[model samples]
Structures are given as C-alpha cells and as structure tokens.
Target: MIITVAHQKGGTGKSTIATNLAVELKTSLLDLDKQHSSIIFNYKRAHAGLEPLDCYSIAESQCRFDGQRPVPEAKLDEFLDLFKGDPKTDLVIDVGGFDSPLNRKALFFGDYLLTPCAPSGTEIYGLQMFEEILQEAEDIAGIHLLTHVLINNADKRSQKRIAEMQAYVKGKPEHFELCQSVIGQRISFKTAYETGQSVVELHEGARTAKLARAYLHSADEMTALCAEIRHALGKGV
Candidate 1:
C-alpha cells in the first residue's frame, strides 16, 4: 500500500509522523519533501549503529518541478506498482507542504492519504485551503479522493479544541475523516527524531528514571496511533 502523509502547510509534524509510522510499522519510506527530512533521519540512524530503515530520498537535485510530473510518471508508477496488492509491504511517502505537481501526483496515487493537522487556528484554516488542493488532484486523477486527517502534536491546551476540529471534519465527511488516535506533544518525539529513532526504540535507551517514564509514555502513545492507523487500513488489530 502507498500511504502518503501530506499537507499544504508546514510544521504540522509530518516528518515526525512519517518516520515513526514507517519505523513502527516496518515499512519503507519515500521522502518526497524538498528538505529531505526522512533521508537525514535515516542517515543519523545508520551512524547511531541502529539497523537502517529502507528509506529512499527522491528530492533535491534528483527531483525537478519543471514538468507536469516531478520524477516522471512511469518512475513513480513502477515504484508504486510493486506495493499494490502486496499485503506484506507498505510504502510510506512524506510529501512536501505545498501545492505542486509532485504533491498533487502523490495525492492522486496514494492508496491511503493522511494529512496531519495541529489543532490551531492557522492549521484549521489551512485545512480548508488544502481541501481545494485535494479537489484539484481528484480532478486530474478522475476520481473522488478522501484523506484521513490526523490531529498531531496535541497538548492539554488543544484537547478542548478537538471538538471544534471534529465538527469541521464531520461537516465535510466526504472530503476527510478524523482519526480516533490523537498524538500528544512530548519531548521524546523531538529527541528521538534528532537521534533518528522511533519513540518505541528511544524508550529503551533512556538515561534517567524521569526520562525513561516520559519516553515510555510517548512510546505508548505512538503504539496506539500506529494501531489505530493499521486497523483503519485493515492490516491488523
């Protein structure tokens, strides 16, 4: 399956969600973001003496936006074709936060599209604009599209705001649906990303008792999030 994580606005924790999901689910990662965030994370993982993930970087000099399709349609098709109907493997794609040919193409091709949105004014408004982008992609692909919206990086302050987000998402049920799993804001997420580790793995390497407890909580949250996503995809319970 081609699981794409995309949004039109940046800093919604896309890389965090993508890398952790790929690691936790044991899937390959395809980084289409111009910043090459996942690629760098994998590099750090390798240097840290951990088993490196099957992450591919298709950005920077290797990618060009001059054409209608970035990296060629056949090239992407060949890669996606390998994963289609293959229950054993999944390709998690992290696309950049912008309206471009590459992002639109990913939307069109993804078997399951995910958009991570933080519960904030800007992000909520941005989702409205992104809905327009999704429509445009569907127009090109000649099919209706729906994306799973994940409320990521949430905290106590945002907990009350989830109802607002839910109402908006429910109002547009045909466009997107909110995931039942909500990922909270935690320091472990940042520290693990910097060191190229998933929260699930980071908890094992914690140094202090307090830190260990925090990391363990983060790991539990991540596990729940991954479980919910997998269940949605009918992978497993």
Candidate 2:
C-alpha cells in the first residue's frame, strides 16, 4: 500500500505528519520532499540508537520542469515503481509543496493520498487550490481520486474553529474526506521530533513529570490516528 502525505501549500505540517505516521506504522518512507525532512529524521533516529527507519530520497534535479511547471519524465515511473510495485510492502511517501508533474504522478500512483491542513483561512485557500490540482490529475489519469484531509495542529481550546473546518470539508464529500482522527497543536510533537523519536516512543523515556504527561497525551492522539488510518486501509482498527 502506497500512502502519500502531500500538499501543494507549505507549512501545513506535512513532514511532521509523514515522520510520525511512518514511525507509528513501522513502514518504509520515500522522501520526495525537497527539504529531505524524513531523511534527516531517520539520521537522527539512527544516531540516537533507535531502530532507524528505512528511508529513501530523490533529488529535485531528477525531475525536469518545463518553464515553471514540471514536464513528465519517463524515469519517474521507474523510480516510483521501486516503491509501488510490491503489493505486500507498505510505502509512505512525503511529497513537496508544489504542483508539478512529479507530485501529480505521485497522486496518481498513491493508494491513499492524504493532505494535512491546519485550521486557518490561508490553509483553507491552499486546500482549495490543491483540490483543483487533484481534479487536473484525475482528468489526466482518467480516474477519480479522493484526498483525505487530516486537520493537523488544531488548537484544543478552539472547538468552534475546528467545527467550522470540519463542516467546510464535509461540504465537499466527493473531493475530500475528513479524517476521523485529529492531531492537536502540542509541544510534545515538536520536542519529540527534535530527538528523532515519535511521541509514542518519547513517552516511555520522558524525563520529568510534566514532560511525561504531555508526551502521553500526544502519544494517545497519535496512536488513535494511526489506528484510524489502518482501519481505513482495511488492515484493522
């Protein structure tokens, strides 16, 4: 199963979602993002003596863009095939923030395409633009696709804002599906990643009482999200 975390807009916590989800699922990750965030995270994990994730990277130079947009490269199929060809392997891909031939191809090849959006006006606009791009990809591929929208970094105190965002996503049932699991804005997410460990792992070794409590909360949320994702994929709840 090829699960891709992608968004054409930046700062939507794409890498955060990808790294945490990959760790929780214990799956191989393909870092197509230009920043190579997942590759760096794996490096930290390896040095920290944690079981390093199986990670790979493809340089942006590999994709040739025509004018401003990327032109399809035949080698892309060969590259993606390395990850998607195996039916039994679960591959998690983190794509960059841009509309390009490479990203569009990833969307077409993905078994489940997930887009993380923060609860804000700007992110909503970006999501709308991504919807257009997804539509274009569908037109080219001759098949319809739905991008699961996960609300990330949600403020726990602002229930109204989260509700409004959910309604907006629910209004477009055909194009997007609102993920049942929501990831909140928590400090543990940042602190845990700095150590190259997921919240699930961090809670086990938390140094202080407050740290342990915070990590435990984040871990529970992450675990629930992973379970929801697995259930959606028909693996189990």
Candidate 3:
C-alpha cells in the first residue's frame, strides 16, 4: 500500500507523522516532498541501529523528490513499472501539500492520500478547500480515498481544542476522519529532528522523553487503523 501524507497547508506535521509511521512499520518508505527533506527521521532509525525486523525498510534513493509537475503520464507509467515490480513493499510519500503535482501524481499511482490539520479554524477551512480541489481532480482521475483528514497537533487537555477538532471532523466525514490519538505540542520532536533521532532515543528523562512516548502510542494506533482501513477498503492482501 502506498500512503501519501499530504495537505495543501504547511506545518501540519505531515512529514513527522509519515516518517514516524514508516519507521514504526519498518517497511519500504519513500519521502516525496523534495524541497523539505525528511531524511532526518530515516537517519535516526539507522543510528538507532537495525534489528531483525521486517518492515518499512526504505530503499537507496534521494530523500528529495524531483518529479515534474502533473507527474506526466510517462512518469506515472515509469513509477507504476517500478511500483508493481516490487509488490512486497509498502510505500509512503510525504508530499508538501495536497495541491502539489506530486499529490496528483500519487492519485494516479493508486495511492491513498492523507492530510493532517491543526485545531485552528482557518486551517480547518483550508483543509476543506484542499478537499474541494482533490474532489475536482478526482472527477477526471480514478483514485480512492484511503482516509482523508487526520487531526494533528491536537491538545487533548483543552476542552475547547478537542471540541473544535471533533466538530471539524464531524462536519467533514465525507472527506475526513478523526484520528484516535492526539499529538500534543512537544519540543522533543523538533529537537530530535536536529540530531536525527526519534524522540524516544533522545534524553528519556526530560519533557521530550514524555512527548516521545506519546508519539509512539499515537503511531501504534495509527498503524493499526491503517491496517483496518485497508481491510475495510478491500485493499489488503
């Protein structure tokens, strides 16, 4: 399965969520957002050292994507050629935004597109606009919505934020679903990125350590949800 984490908006934690999920799964991972590299997470996993585990093991490729816009049909054909050539691998592309040509290319590749949003209403409205664009593209292209919107950077302790997230999700079920886990604002995540380490690998005694554990829990739940979604969509093997 190719799950592309994308949104038309920035700072929504798309790379963070997608990168961590790939590490958690230990399968072949692909970072599609070229301009903003996410090799930091992959570097962390490598520094953490390899285990005797079979999962999203990424291939030898540049973390930066250099595909042309609209993913020219030939590009899609070439990708499909390579994609189908390796049926055992699962792919995850971290697109900068939902409106990018990379995302349009992903749709043609029969991949699932997921977008993350914050608690802000403007961001929420941006997501709606993003969905509108996607739907418009979908009218001409054949694609599937594995799962649409995922709430990121949420503060569960805030009754107001929780209510806002819930309300936004409820209002956009046709194009979104609320993730069960909430990722609180944690500085550890940003700090770990500099050293290319999972927040779990950083100083486990500080506030960052606490955030790392929380992130792990969220990733676990998300991984399971992804599996269930595949089954529900009849895309599982």
Assess every candidate by TM-score.
Answer: 0.91, 0.90, 0.70
- Per candidate, the number of residue pairs that clash is 0, 0, 9
RMSD of each: 3.9, 4.8, 5.8
Cα error, residue 106 of model 1, in Å, equals 1.3
Clashes of 2: 0
Q: What clash pairs does model 2 have?
A: none
**Per-residue C-alpha lDDT of model 1 across residues 72-94, encoded as one tens digit per residue:** 44477677777765778798889
Worst 10 residues of 2 by lDDT: 63-72
lDDT per residue for candidate 2 within 65-183, as digits (tens), equals: 21122223556677567667455678788898888887788898888889998888888888889989988888999989898999999997988888888888999887899998889
Cα distance off (Å), candidate 3, residue 41: 3.6
The digit string of per-residue lDDT tens for model 3 on 83-189 reads: 54254556666766537655566655644566777777888778778778668666767554534666667665676976786687778776676665555566656
Pairs that collide, model 3: 7-98, 8-98, 26-55, 26-56, 27-55, 27-56, 27-57, 28-56, 28-57
lDDT of 2 at 1: 78
- Best-fitting candidate, scored by TM-score: 1
| TM-score: model 1 vs. ground truth | 0.91
Q: How close is candidate 3 to the true structure, as a TM-score?
A: 0.70
